[model samples]
Target: MTFKSINPANGEVIASFEEDADYALKIRLGEKSFDRWKNTGIEERIKLILNLAVILEARKAELAKEISLEMGKTLKSATAEIEKCAITAKYYCQIAEEQLGSIEVSNYAHKAYYKYEPQGGILAVMPWNFPYWQALRFAIPTILAGNVVLLKHAPNVFMSATTLEKLFIEAGFENGIFQNLLVGIDKIESIVADRFIKGVTLTGSNLAGSSLASLAGKYLKKSVLELGGSDPFVVLADANIESAATFAVKSRFQNAGQTCIAAKRWIVVDEVYEEFLNKVSEKINKLKAGDPFNTESDFGPVARLDLAEKIEGQINFLVKKGAKKLINGVRKGCLLTPTLLNMSRDLSHSFTEELFGPVACIITAKNTDEAIEIANETNFGLGASLWSQNLEEGEHLLQKLNAGSVYLNSMVKSDASMPFGGINQSGYGRELGVYGFYEFCNVKSYIIEK
Candidate 1:
């Protein structure tokens, strides 16, 4: 069977490609490349990684267009995503030497140090959201650390998967240093268990994370899982309501509300609830849902038709549980207008479950205590956004909020300069930054004799 990539905007077929059935061959290739690459000088790797940034910029338009068509991301957002990926790749190159270098430690015998050694080939099972960014950020760091990469990108973005492979090749990397295999999900378990694959990192749903985590555990291989996030955007009464509402609208609706760390729930203090709601609702109404490639489009289609169905289904569940829609939802195929909802908090799936599309829910809290409570209520402990003019209050609340990363008076976004990941069901392990650059490396200690 052919793997088809359909454009969500107009329901057109972007392209169709054959899935790579030669998993063993690719695994062998990755293993061989890792053996040779692990001994390759860090300076060379850094140079190649920096070259990727140059190439990404040169082909920004093409890459962004592919992402926009494959995943229904607005052209503007898609371009921004590519730029962010390029920046991340280069940043990782800048810090790889220091981050992956050996560190000295005191030992009684003589001298001791921590050695960061590459184990072998690493597998990256990435999601379609942020198609290029998510995959590149993972692969670049792993490969730079001297381990080869086997990317098992989401099948929906097969074209993107191949493009990324070509990207690394064009950057003067040797064959198999970074390879993208167009394979089905069913093959991932054995690939993770393969003796050649040293570790696995996945960025996808909780269900997928669980399956891959189990396989990695069963085989005693290291695994990093970055799963779903139903993050809360907390707005306090003392906050700048106008700025809070504006950011809320941006955080929730950007990318058609498909981001893992996007503010899914808006928790507001009662004193400013009405004002915040009115402010955000008006902006939500102004969102333009149209062709993704169009410059004027603000909201594009959710990746696929089924995703839109899931969004609609969740909204229906919430409305049945006494929740009310603040704005009438306009949905056509994969295109959905920004939806503002007043959550009833009735034990409904919509209240607790994650809505992965252009849907935003509002929950009012009487005070800061209630706001904190509502923020921590979700099963997902990913990134969160806190809106408050009082820096001291937001700083103190940081320790109280149950999330991996919390932004103060700003939107939560992944940066190569900082560690990005989540806690609880949002999954374990971190990615990006110095902390993540060494996730798949062997942090070993050895003492020298005098």
Candidate 2:
């Protein structure tokens, strides 16, 4: 099958490529690469990854443009994403030795220690929204753990995916360390089911994550999925309204609201609901939606025209369901204005659905209990933000948010040092920090009798 990558900014065909890998070839390459990479010393792997980090920094601008042209992320944001990729690589390079160091445990029968051994070739199915960062987040730790990578990147970011492979090779990595399989979604099941592929990691929609998880389970292989999130941004009556509203707008509108953990629902206390709404709406209107290549543009076009249409469709549905439109939903090419919808009813589609654009659904709550209830009503449990002046109340709400990560007076974001993942429909297993490095590792136990 042939896949054509279209520019999201104006719907022009940027490039086209044919799917080239068969099941047999994928299996063979994975097995062959695993044999070499799994046995390579950790120091050597770390050295190569550090070199890749250097390469990423030197060619940051080039990679940023590729991301912008292919996926419509602003050039500035794309550059930041590349820099984040370099940071991820550098993080593993600096800490792999200590992080993966063998830990000795005392036992009654014998002295045993756990050795962090590679789980062979890992299959990463990444998303286009964060073309580089998503891939690097998984690649850095997996490679540093002495495992080979087989990336089946999002079809839209094909050029960036191939460029990443070249960057790894240029950094003096041996063949098979990081391989980009230019395969379509149809080919993923066979490649993932292969006996040589040890585990799978994905950062995409809930539907895709569920399908991949089911496939991985059919083969009894390990899988880590970071799926969709309808994260709540809850502001209490005692919170700093100005600061909370500012962070709320940034959280919901960043990446044109394409982020998985973007604050989709804003639950504000009735005491300050009107004030918060006015502040947030003002900020939203200030965002400049234009060409992603422009340095001054705050918002860019959605990754694809279809996504924009989907978001618009959701807005229409909300309008039909008695949602009062606080801001008019309009589109120019793939660019969409940041919109706010006040859902008239509590269990409406506008309040329940994951709006993957700059559409924020405001739900007014009487108090803290109501806010928590509204926040946990969604199936997703990825991330949540709680804003309050009271430290005790903020901490208490964090404990009750039902999310993997909770922030107080801050936006929801993943840090390299923190373990990031979710529960329920948001998917399972953890990524980032030491936990992520160990995900693709084996913990074998040994016993001896004296």
Candidate 3:
């Protein structure tokens, strides 16, 4: 069987790649490559990553275009995603040596320290949205810390996957150091169970994360999962209403709203509910959803026909359950119109499921306490944003949110300098930052007595 890349903007097959028939050989190659890569100094890895960043910057336009063609994200957003990846690479390069250095436990009569060491090959199961950013976000730090990556990218974005693999090679990565395995789901278990594959890291749905985590556990391998999120953008009564409305539009609709950390739920207090809703709806109307290649377009397609269909179905279900459609949504092919739904607090129980599209749900709260209560109603606790002019109160309210990351007057986003992950059904384990570098490493304790 072959993995086909279908352009979501139009029903066109851009390319197809045959599944890796010799995965065992590839695993062996990863094993061999890891042996050498793990032995290489951090300084050497840093140099290569610096080169990789340079390549990413130089080919930003071309790479962004490929991303747009494969996944249907607007050219501008795709370019920004590529830019973020390159910045992340450079960030890791700057911090890797210090972060991976041995931590001095004690140094009296006996010297003692705990060091971060590489653990063979890591299998990365990445999703299609923000394809390059998601893969490199995990791979950069993990690889810099001395692990090889066997990436199993989403099938629809295989061109981006292969392009990344080629870019790794061009940046002087060994044949097996950063290999993209064009394999199906059936092939994952064996790869995870292999001796060379030390651990697994996945950025996808809760179901996928559960299955992969189960496999990793069955094989006694470590697993890190960054899964689905129904992140809340809480607009308190005291917030800068104008700014909150503007950012709410941006956070919900960016990447056509397929983001894991996007503000999926807008929990607005009663005081500013109508005002915030009106402003956001106006912004939504002004958005230009068109061809991914179009410079003038704000966003594009949903990445697949099924994804668009799924999103529409979810909207319909909510509407039937008495959710008021403040702004109607339209679906044509893979392009979905941005939607806004005013959800009754009684139906708060239904907020658990994620509608991965350019759709936003506003859940009204009587007050701040009710707002926090409504925010915590979901099974997903990925990330959230609390908008309030009172900095202290916002910080205090943030603590009540059940999410991995919480921001005050800002949209939830991933920064290379900060650790990013989620809690509850959003999945376990952390990615990005120094903590992420240690996720797939062996934190070995060393002691020497004279």
Give the winner by TM-score: 3
Clashing pairs for model 3 are none
Q: TM-score per candidate, in order?
A: 0.98, 0.97, 0.99
Better candidate number, 1 or 3, judged by lDDT: 3
Instruction: Give the Cα lDDT of each candidate.
Output: 0.87, 0.87, 0.92
Worst 10 residues of 1 by lDDT: 344-353
Q: Candidate 2 on 1-450: residue-level lDDT in tens?
A: 877788888889988988875646755776787787777787888888889889999999999999999999899999999998888888778888898887877878666777888878889999999998999998889888878889989898898988998998899986677888888788888888787789999999888999999999999999999998999899999999999999999889989999999888889889999999989889888898889988789978999888999999989988887788998869876889888888742654235567899898888888999889888888889999999999986897799999999999999998888999999889899999888799978986666566
Measured by lDDT, the strongest candidate is: 3
Across residues 1-450, which tens digit of lDDT does each residue of candidate 3 receive?
A: 978999899889999999999978988999999889998998899999999999999999999999999999999999999999999999988888899998998567388899999989999999999899999999999999899999999999999999999999999988999999999999999999998888999999988999999999999999999999999899999999999999999999998998999998899998998899889988999998999888888899999999999999999999998998889989999999899998887776655678899999888899999999988988998999999999998899899999999999999999999989999999888998788799999999888898
Q: How accurate locally is residue 298 in candidate 2, as Cα lDDT from 0 to 100?
A: 92
**Model 3 segments beyond 4 Å from truth?**
107-109
- Per-residue alpha-carbon lDDT of model 1 for 1-450, expressed as tens digits? 578899998889989988787878989987878778999999999999989999999999999999998989988998898899888887888788888888998758588898888899889999998889898888888888888999899888999989999999899998789998888888888888789888999999989999999999999999998999988899998899899988888888989999999988889999999999889988888889889888899968999999899999988888787778888787899999888888754442235577898889898888999888888887889998998888997899988998999999998998888889999989989898886678999988888896
Winner on TM-score (1 vs 2): 1
State how far residue 109 of model 2 sits from its true place (Å): 2.5
Off by over 4 Å in 2: 348-351
Clashes of each: 0, 0, 0
